[model samples]
Target: MTSPQPLPAYSRDRLAERLAAGPVVCGEGYLFELERRGYLQAGAFVPEVVLEHPEEVAALHRQFVHAGSDVVEAFTYYAHREKLRVIGKDGILEPLNRQALEIARGVADTTGTLLAGNICNTGVYDPADPATHAAVREMFTEQVGWAAEAGADYVIGETFRYLGEARIALEVIRAAELPAVILLVAGHEPVTRDDVDITDACRELAALGADVVGLNCVRGPATMLPLLGPIAAAVDVPVAALPVPYRTTAEQPTFHALRDPGPTPLPEDLPFPTALDPFTCHRYEIADFTRRARAAGVRYFGLCCGAAPHHLRAMAETLGRTPPASRYSPDMSKHVYLGADTRLRAANQAYRTSL
Candidate 1:
């Protein structure tokens, strides 16, 4: 095969241009997937894997791209100083964040996808504590600065449970003069943790210069969809919708609230975080969500937490895209037992009768 072509430097207009045109797909959930791969720990989710194993992180980025991601999001989700300090490794915080950006930068540059620097819920944002609020800004500022220096096309501030925290992130991104996609985590509450109505919070962020605003993470498609319509109607900026691939319901509005009713006991009382495998939505389910989200006026289509490449591929295809990974889409026609192909062995086909 011929070597790939080298393109000119990015103009950083990709996010705005793409959103103005149509939907753009961004894949998240590096921490969960990397933990499952045994390269990182789950509880802390510090993403030191990016520093320890940069190549694997790059490969994952490429997989997401192949599966139809329009952006290669740097895996700095929990690489903040606060998280590292909890693990007694705040010393390498900057290096870790920079490494994550570098790894994602390589994939985006090579594949011609938009590179996005990411900051998420700092977890220490206490509304009453003015000190914690300042700390969060310091964390976001440094991360966004590194992203801008790394030539990232834009920055994504996602999974903010407090509209207040999300607003701070938007302010930092705007101050950097880079486009901001601020996504809040609605969790199980109808409003943000600070009691701000979801629609109003999204509108407030949009008015504050957020290029895009919507809900992401915590809730699954089933729970997240109901909120998208209102928020889309409330905000004029491009709306973003990215839910986890879990079967969250009205009874259990968030994945953490899901209870496995099976006789077999889960490790914990609830089946969130590490034990949500059974609730994972199939690709077809994701496809359905994708179609609904597109129709709801969500221009930025993204997936978080429990997302895998196939889940992303399904969303992409539903958005009218035939990404490169579509080449390997499942074909029952090639199955020996389930398929009707004449080349299939008769013995294997006999199982059609439930043998």
Candidate 2:
């Protein structure tokens, strides 16, 4: 009889600590050659490229590693079957997905770094919409499973819209016996279907199985900064985030308000305001994003969308010189303890003497 393979032992919090101990992981998303070569459509998620230009994938991974990313995520975020079908390479799903993980591992070995398994929502948001739930779960399970099999140190389910999808993905990671982090995508709205509020959502995911929870790839830093406090108040786990700011007036106020029973605004009718100009972003904006992120007690920070090497370099420099906060100080904890109901009750003994 063949011996059984030993299960892997890992959890989410341990992964969070590892990420926190080092410089922030920085990266951006772009299509691989397979997608660029007309094998895939323009808007759908791109597949992992194994048959072509594996060296290019490795090169991209090395760029982030050399650019000072403590963790370099693989480009397997869209390696799920549904996306492969869009790319006409449905038959190559397993091989391409596995190869993406291998490429990430190889780059990490050469660069002496950490590799985050890339898993993402199938770009579907609504759980109640029966039209897509099963498909979503199936894609998440397959991609996450492949990442685990390829020996990823950790898995990242990023840019997810709903908690249901996030929960389903995390369950798969647990079944695979792997450590996982979930990065939810928040809109202008706050509360989600679960009544877990953002911070509470983080706590709930942590309690369920997530090791770290935070936001990524929604609006720019200005908008994202405001939500951090509520999110912090709701969860005890470490937060990791990457805010993807828009490039120009063409992207602002991205969400639409309800039009009365009258004519709805077409895409052509909407106005795009440039909250920050130049399509990229200003130095102060980047610095401010870092400042707010730190204030929110975020343990990890990175960029998306318009972020480039200079922007990342600016963030690294800005954080290096910024003063650390005293929120975790002994005095603060003592004050909190003394303000608690137990402490208050203990201090009320003088009333007994009066009685």
Candidate 3:
């Protein structure tokens, strides 16, 4: 392999400066939503859409940024070389990442929002094999280099299931002299895919100089909330919680296990494709989680898969801030019509003739 390219000069202290000012509201989970809406192929999950359909990608970023996202993450979740290779598009990794960053940069520049260069699980890291380890490092180095070249404010290594793989990505991002956020995917057991304890993992990543370390993607807020206190106690850096918007129950801690194999449709009640509307938390619920997370010392907060613009809007409102696009005046009237009591009262009033 050729020598790793030199990264452009960028401020490594920007993320820390931004975080110190206030909480960060990020918008993630573009692949699942884009595919469900017919913008991209479902099974292939190719990220060339950034290059082929830049408008659509930029539009999504605009929605999040307008909805109060502090950071507009590049839609490069599965854009890694190895992931592209699975779909026979390995040769376009550079273009895919570069275009994705460019789109995100444009949105951020227009809205005055920060841009995060994203890198997720590469699906090629193996601690047991020396060759695989070298390949994994090189893959991350190349990706981070592209992001730095595109003027990303910081780099986030998220949704990594394996501690080793997450560490590798963190190392590469740090080597680029950019602030790094490392997010791990956890199950109900409070352990990673490799069975390492989450608290232990956070401590290790923090020790390795991760600017921010926390959990995301595998479980919903209800499931991930229980793990936050321990992680906060384990690490000194800010804790991040970007759970999926779905109601991930104990029976199905992770979203991937929610569906069976084959083309069979999930049960109508299942909140797979319709997560943004059905399974997502209301603004009040997001407010409640934010309150709890703040109490738990979690500084960075956002949504993972199944997130929509409204979710970010609610989060920002709950934090007592208005987004760039403020449509409604601050009022408690909407909350009055939102709970079970309102529905129960209406049902009770209408059922008098049933006797």
Candidate 4:
């Protein structure tokens, strides 16, 4: 018989202390990652896997930490009641949220990592419906409560397309007395779903007590980087940047809006959620993004959808960190054809270009 794992013990209010020290990196994109690992359903995107496969969730948190993330965000990006109800698993909401926080909490304590509890968009938001607004607040209250009860160091309310919804999440996190990191996912139009401009949304959220505020999700490096400058200038707080790892351009800004340049039509003509491989940025591109974001005043760095351990390592190396994964960063000199080592064969080295 196997022994039971010890309950996770979390330490609170550490995220503010971390930011006071310097720029910090948080690992995100748990939904896509777990989906790629065959443990999650992509379209549903709810984190029921936390209840069914706790070890897998824990292992991902450890991987991000090992790759140089300063924070271990709980795998609860879409664990709210609204998302659970969409997937017909509303009955398991409490257990799923608790399990995700527990898994993340345990992993965070091991490496002394900053633990972040996550809550994302609620799918159902209406500008005119008072009932909808109440529902959104009710949902955030429960998730925020679970995070606080689970000892979250801070809570991240991310990818809110509507500034109205962002306000609700911020209000709840403030009431819980946890430091809040609010990130808005502006679409291709440079405005939130509610038509509030991205910069104004971030600035207002910062004014409303978001400890860290900036852009995250939907858009990639190219499209997302431009918005950071204005938001950083508008707010005194540390700015966060966590774009998806894709090659988005001016004409087709967001990842969902990207059109393949290779002239071969994509199978679905929609390269977002699962078919975004061709548009994924190389690790070196991620490193370049890190350097540029730092220059643009983005103090909190991460990747959203399409994030992998290698991308996080690249970001860390750019910031002069040597996380455990840095041990294997490419050494081209070791290559048989491109060798600079004394033991290399002259003929193979000389044939590099032709081969």
For residues 290-354, write the lDDT of model 4, one tens digit per residue.
99999999999999988999999999899888999999989988688886776888786677757
Best lDDT among the predictions, by candidate number: 1
Error of 1 at 177 (Å): 0.5
Cα RMSD of all models vs. native, in order, equals: 7.0, 15.8, 6.0, 7.4
Cα lDDT of model 2 by residue, 73-190, tens digit:
7777677777778778789888887787888899888876667787786766476687677788778788887787777777888877678888878777777777777888766565
* lDDT for each residue of candidate 1 in 146-257, tens digit (9 for 90 to 100): 9999988899999898988998898888888888899988877879899999898898888777888998888999999989999899978899999999999999999889
Sorted by lDDT, highest first, which candidate order results? 1, 4, 3, 2
Clash count of each predicted structure = 0, 3, 0, 0
Model 3 TM-score? Answer: 0.85
Q: Which stretches of candidate 4 lie over 4 Å from their true place?
A: 1-13, 261-268, 353-355
Residue by residue across 39-101, what tens digits does model 3's lDDT show?
Answer: 887656777779888998998898888888889898888888888888887878888898899
lDDT: worst 10-residue window of model 1? 1-10
* Model 3 worst lDDT run, 10 consecutive residues: 332-341
Cα misplacement distance, residue 156 of candidate 1 (Å):
0.5
